[model samples]
Target: MPKNALGAAGPAVLALVLGLWGITREDSMWRDEAATWMAAGRSPAGLRHLLDHADVVHGCYYLLMHGLFEVFGPGLVTLRLPSVLATACAAAATAATGRRLAGPWAGLLAGTAFVLMPSTQRYAQEGRSYALVVAAVAVATWLLVTLAQDRPAARAATWRWVGYAGAMLVAALLNWFSLLALLAHAVTVLRAGRLGAGRLPRHWATAAAVVVTGALPLVLVSRAQARQVAWIPPLTWATAPAPLCLLGTGLLCGLLLRRRPGAPARTAAPAVSVVWAGLPLLAVPVLALLAASLIKPLYIDRYVLYANVGLGLLLGAALAVVVRSWRPFTALFLAASAALLPLHLGLRTPQSRVDDVLAPADAVARVSRAGDGVLFIPSLRRDTAEVSPQLFAGLDDVALVRSPADSGTLRGVEAAPARIREAMLAERRILVVGDPEDHPGGPGDATKRRVLAAFFVRCADAETRGRRVQVYERGTSCSSTPARRL
Candidate 1:
């Protein structure tokens, strides 16, 4: 294979292997992915209603997944395969961009490093829009590099700009956080302008404007649903370490360049371009979000996952500097893989996520009897049963007023507190599905627990995979009714 092909194909193939290794996580699905599965299974009207009410930012991704589910049917593979393919494409784009700015060796290494990163492996198997957003941004970044270096005139340049804009628009539609990539690209374009790439910066501005304009409506609508991000914690010393570690590693790799980024020497120009491109992409988006988070607390490492491509490029460039021989490079890569083996293995397990959304079903099956009333504290735990409705088949959902699809919401709408109390009182036996014992549930959950405690006594309790299933019998005292086996 040609060096360019090797650079692009090697990392892509590796990404696929890693992504597919445990794509199903032994047939487990977490809550976030459960959200995707439920949304994708909805009818067009239901999906439109969902957008009107919540998750408008994920509207495009949900629709795309809906199409895939329509054809493939909603299995774990169908739900997660697109993310794997998107991650592979992102690895290819990252390699191509590094190759354009540095060389084939650097590009290949960068791509390899990206595939090995834990974040890439984690999201590559998730059924979400983040991986797709990364792919779009990586492709757009590669196109920007081509335009800067080739400096193609007239039609060719126009076509590249068009591709760039389209790629960026797709990313923005998938997740508006991806728009941060343009900030990194703008720095790259300014560097190109400094290097006498006339008209390129102006062309980039036009392409960026088009992308922003196209995604403006989504931006406005998603903003209206701002409560969707209400769970994101405020930035503080606790949240500072992760991004700092990532940015610190990138800086360390950059030091390996051992040259001024603005060097004007003909042979050193590529190195300068690589540094300018990779460093900004590595630093800017993360820093911008961190600064913004100080005001509103929106910083999440996953939100800026595309920045890992920049780190990969820098690591590749640094590795290329020392590992002139393929044998040494292979040895070093193998050593790094060995060090990450445990983490990679962990990513494929059901325990990797916060909670296995399907795990509660087994416990529910064990404790529930025909006609028993089921109630989910905090409501969203309804996802646990939704993904495995068969196990919950005989149980009555006592508080649900409307299904998620019927309500146009992620979680089904529940009855008012008074109505919920009235409904629960009618049941002789009720099953309480809740988060882990340590979880401090919201006021609504507290109210539900208080109501349950007033009339029902716990007969049995079981916790598995981050969920708690408690069997309750009517009567404040459990002394009369024997405690049931778990």
Candidate 2:
């Protein structure tokens, strides 16, 4: 009700969010987190080399976290804190914008939703760019609204344009996926008079420049990336459902809230905001389905968290609109969120699919020696093996040794099969964990059988919650070559 109370509560909500996200997630970092940690180690120059050449992640977020870790303590907390803070900042920004659009009460409501919304809370805990990207997109939208408010005096208008342009630039730097946010913004504003006439033309010109600058790196990298184009099929529709759900629900809620009576704004402005936030989340799935029809490989959900923010904010707003004076509504929201606390603290948190070992990982962690090198043989199942780094922490090295070339330290990428054989040549003791994919036991599948056979004379099998672990010792009986025993 009061300005003082809203301002005070903003940080409190943010603190509650950060507390939930940060303190408990220290036990396990998911696959994408591992990927970020792995990427954070690259020299800034090395990252530039990777980015100037290979830009799927768009290079900027990794490089920023790389610097943050240098200052923060190079631990899980350090890797994750920036993102946690970013999510909070995004929530705070959403509140500020809500305050601008509606009033302090509305701002507080929206901000609270941004922080406490389950999906937002879940991602804020992760060591990835989604949280930071969420914040940036929020800030960019806020700035867009500021521009649309149109303080036409030269200085204010110029400043609004500057803030708008700068926020767009930073958002692009954070996540290329935010490109969808930018496209959505451009579309909504244009449809309204927000970007109409001379203003619209200039805005388009500036936006075109911003997009070109942002996409230049991607276009260049995508060229040489033809070698990896085979992996692009994962972008298809059959596999696109998760992202669609992520973005669509968020957009739907935001639109629903933004359009409600007493929503404290004209329909057109909030409509534009909803459209801005929703389009990319909406389009990527469509594109993925198209790609899936054409090819068939590469789809995932975590990054879709960026699209979820608008939804979360809108959902919060919708809840506020409906339950304005209802204690039960507030209690229901708080109670449902609070109930997730135990899972959040436990290693069993749902994101563990990306963060830790399911059953098989626990099996290996339990039975295998720290010195045992575990290989998820089929390799490249990033989520399934998401728990590997955490399980092997200070214990063993895990790799996708699809081949011999992966022996020694090749980071986490799959190594050539021959290189692995050569690297393990001298080890008097070796343990190989085989993947089921390598042994489908089908026609003309002797090569797969031979690889498995060569690695084991004895198969020691173990089982954990969701996975099966089988250990193999070298044996001559299964191979014509009579491989040496350890």
Candidate 3:
């Protein structure tokens, strides 16, 4: 291939990436993302306060983004650029891996497949580390495969291993659970018997040493923070682990896993195949079981995004091996995946839908005219990312009740009855949510039921994909007089 041709692949694909990124830019932040922004925005001292009192599972990611916001500033675009850049680089990396192991066709298909997976595109569009983690995972895995396959070790292989180790370390720093992917990679390498037995032990010892040395402090800190954390429930076939994993994996890697190679590497077909099919399948269950024992039961699909690229490349590899003459069918498959890109962006990319966890604006629209006075029930704030901003920061009138946050329309309420009454009286209409009744006082689920029904008139009732948000109007009192004007 001409050097110019190789160079063309990058910018050619980058154009598509730049365009696709624009389409997913306005996606509303889900609960975790919103909280991430809020937490990272706090001053260094305030962040320390948050770590001691709030979720510390990803304090490093928070700190990194804090630095990022210093350079790029905040809001949806500034926040999500990392994921977008990570995914775009992953696409380029996928192409390079393919071109290295197979050929130009393989590289193109692999990159295309990467951008098409609903999950890949979805995470790429979010303001979190999942996309970056997955990209690092792919780049690292490719380097590891390059290392293992070297009959006569080249500088490339050493650089690849060095890169792989560094990538794994960065991923661990961003989100520790990503260690599961690296662990699975190690296991797959072990199971394949590729690294001579003695070499294998040495290789693993280094990996273990790195993971323990790097991740140990974060793990210890997380233990202390767990006391204040809520219990994450177990996974089911449906939603425990993200449902996207099953569907995306099936669409992307299922065929490649079971298929036998009919053709040779277009560029190392055999070993790369092992990394593709095995790591993700092993990583998911391994993490689930391990987490069940030590941490609160939990599974989030985005955590394993590195596996998605492996699947995409394998999918590319399978096509390369099997579809020797079926050019038209290959075109069709690629086109269909590309065509679905908009749908994924529209609904899944930002994790959006009619029934998304309440939009921050919904909380804003309610309190916009209340002289910017926003009062949010802290209990409800815990429910989703929109909790703090949408509920209170919709405008300048934001206040926190049942919360330690000082800058708000109301304060020191402690979910107290007198306080709820006071914020309601001071603001136009207090938009209480989640367990509305339980905060101030209640016998059970019905605790705040009567009060909400009695005073707050139902303005809107709606549900989508199971997330439900109801708007209520408090009957006109002197407190609500200004709201009527709104």
- How far residue 421's Cα lies from its native spot in candidate 1, in Å, is 1.2
What would the TM-score be for candidate 1 when compared with the true structure? 0.94
List model 3 lDDT by residue over 1-486, tens digit each: 324255226623662465355543444556556666776677776666667665676677778888888787876776777777788777777766655555556666666676777777667766678877777776776566555555335455455556777887887778777777766675656653553523533564576577668877887788776653444555555553454544455445445535554344442434444334333543454455445645555555665667666666666655665556576776778677678867765754334622233454454454345443333344334334333444444432223343433321112223445544544445434443442222453332232345456666655443323234444556733343322312
lDDT of 1 by residue, 1-486 (tens): 137699999999999999999889987898999999888988889899988998999999999999999998989999999999999999999888877766777788889889999999999999999999999988998888887777677999888899999999999999998889899988988888887888888888999999999999999988999998999999878779988998998888777675532212223334236777888898999999999988887998888999988998888777766666445776867798899989999999989998888878888887678999998977999998778889999789998999888889988988877788788889999988888763666555666788777888889887777788888998876644566646
User: All candidates' lDDT scores?
Assistant: 0.85, 0.55, 0.56
TM-scores, each model vs. reference: 0.94, 0.72, 0.75
Error of 3 at 234 (Å): 2.9
Candidate 2 Cα lDDT to native: 0.55
Error of 1 at 484 (Å): 5.7
* Residue-level lDDT for 166 in candidate 2: 69
Give the lDDT ranking, best first.
1, 3, 2
**Prediction 2 TM-score vs. true:** 0.72
* TM match of model 3 to true structure: 0.75
